[model samples]
Target: MDTPLISASALLGASPAPLLLDCSFDLADAAAGEQAYVLGHLPGALYVHLDRDLSGAKTGMNGRHPLRTRDEYAAWMASVGIGPDREVVVYDRQAGMFAVRAWWVLRWMGHTRVALLDGGVDAWVRAGGSLATDVPVPKPVAITPAPAPAMPTLDAAAVLARLPGLRLLDARAPERYRGDVEPIDRVAGHIPGARNRFFKDNLQADGTFKPAAQLRAEYAPLVDGAAKGSVVVSCGSGVTACHDVLAMEVAGLGTATLYPGSWSEWSADPERPVEKSPAA
Candidate 1:
């Protein structure tokens, strides 16, 4: 697929339609996503919790939302009726913030046929799609694991070693990037030599992504003549960083490595260096 996003209208009209997953989540309120899903969601869509379903156990050192092992992830995908042949669609209320995490994970686990629902639940409503409160039970299926990961990833140690040589893109808010505010992680600053891109910048006023050409133009400078592979995208707890990865793919810029540990894992270690921008 050229882009990892599917428009609401296109989704609604698709034949042999793909399975829909509601990945809505709130960092502050852990149970909000399920609550929202129970209240209303797209017809035949299943809910996937960010903390419970998407992430593995947190050990304070593995970052807040660490990834599960390949075997574990594959098992979960089977339980959700996702397999190599399944075409999946994921979405959330926060513009693709939480949904793209699932999107990235599926790709990481070697499932290639997946896409984010553009504009999320709001877009569905706007497209005249009605909500269904009933949750469907997904039939379990055997999943075939791929030999290699389709999505690339990096840990804190790898990121640290690369340092100033690689282009590190911080997908956090400007304040967090500048150490002005940090409501979640322990430390307020970002990794040294990383540039702030704010994942939301890739979206338009309507919450849908901008045109591919525009995204390419805005992100081209950030790459700075480096190959796309040399660029790494990160955010607090490694969730929002996938938004940038998806945007880069949508922009036809190829994929960038994901720093799954991100700031949460980096800041937990005092020995790791942190950089704070000058106060404005």
Candidate 2:
């Protein structure tokens, strides 16, 4: 069986057809991603905004991009022409960062036919796949959404509960993890015991993810002897963390619980311990 990645060439010839979603987004510029999508995308790709569609309505300390309710997410999926058990191929700007959010959401909702466009839109264009400026019109679908709240998640308290036994992976840049630079979050540094593994490290020089064996090796140290539920994945606002989850799943490590609030919510509280210097 192939990995959860669908390459540009494979996408070009996908049988039974695959629903392509453009999940391009600039965290710095909220509107830029949508603007890029409106300019041009795959022939039949639909845009999935990180803020508007993929995430929930932010009320307070719930983090920047919280997961939406099952009903809301399913409705959005339907509007994008997603049917139950349909094949989906999500893409972003040549990197799997943002697109995997859609992939993770689908899997959380019990849709197993979801995959990502390896190397993303740039890979498609580079591979001679045509782009379309015209937006696609997909017929709205009506399907009962499957809710799996048990989809391996860690709440702010859950993280604290398992603090001693947990192996938390922080998917932020090294600088952010070291407290050398704080880009988007309120505070610098990371959860006291969490290890740093930049999500981009999962990709090759060409931006496609590393092969399964390599990824398995990369994760083996952290996952050894750990109960699957004890591994928590997190990042700034819980976005890029999915990239690591996707990579791990590709690596056959199975799925880890997502700390959706992540550092964003964790840091907001003064009680949680924050560590600045890197581990010895």
Candidate 3:
């Protein structure tokens, strides 16, 4: 199935083939998921929280948020009644922050038939779509865990070994990238040989993604003359980095692999070098 933004009207009626997911989450507020869902959500949408559903136990020194295992994610999907053939549509409160993470996870697990809701729930409401306060409890569907693809990922050793060939794309704000300000992690700065590309840059003023042609033009110079697959994306803790990956996909560029550890893991080890300037 081709990736296309689905409308709230299309999802209101019975859509057995389509799975509508409301991936609304706020990192600061843990109760944001149910609060947002309770206020009013797209009709017949299932809620998926980033911290509760998408992540696993935070083992110290590993990362701030580690991804759940494949089996875990598959079980959660099955419990939420997502089947392999279902055309999934994910949306979040803001543009596509949390929704894009779900999109990337599906892609990593080898599911290609998924799309983000353009402009998200706000757009749906503006388009005269219906909303419901009550959450729908769906019957569990059996799902087989698909094998995750062995895309190019890098550890500190691998990054050090191929520093020249691999272009690390840091999907953090310019301030955080430059060690000017860090509100989350303990240490500031970025991985060595990494370039900053704030994830928000991929979106328009209205929170929707820019056109494919515009996105292509913006990213072409960055990956120009590089090998078929040379870009690796990382963020504070691997969540927002998927935004960059999705943008690259929309731009018609080859899929960029994610560094799930990101800065959270990279900074844990003082032995690994961190750079404050672009030259670093």
State which candidate has the highest lDDT: 1
Candidate 2, 27-139: lDDT as tens digits: 88889888999898998888888999999988678888888888888888888888886789999994988998898888888777889999998889889998889997877
Q: What is candidate 3's lDDT per residue for 13-118, written digit by digit as tens?
A: 4356467788888878878866888889887788888888877888766677677788888888788877777778889887887888888777666667788887
List candidate 3 stretches off by more than 4 Å.
Answer: 4-17, 150-152, 278-280
- Model 2 per-residue lDDT at 66: 88
- Model 1, 1-280: lDDT tens digits are 4459999999999889899999999998999999999999999999999988899999988899999888888888999998778899999999999999999999998788999999999999999999999989988898666447778898888888898777999999999999999998999999999998999999999999999999999998899788857789999989999999999989888899999989999999999999999866
Assess candidate 2 and give its lDDT.
Answer: 0.86
lDDT winner, 2 or 3: 2
Enumerate residue pairs that collide in model 2: none
The candidate, 1 or 3, that scores higher on TM-score is 1
lDDT of all predictions: 0.91, 0.86, 0.79
Model 1 misplaced regions, further than 4 Å: none
lDDT of 1: 0.91
Residue 15, candidate 2: C-alpha displacement in angstroms: 1.5
For model 1 the TM-score comes to 0.97
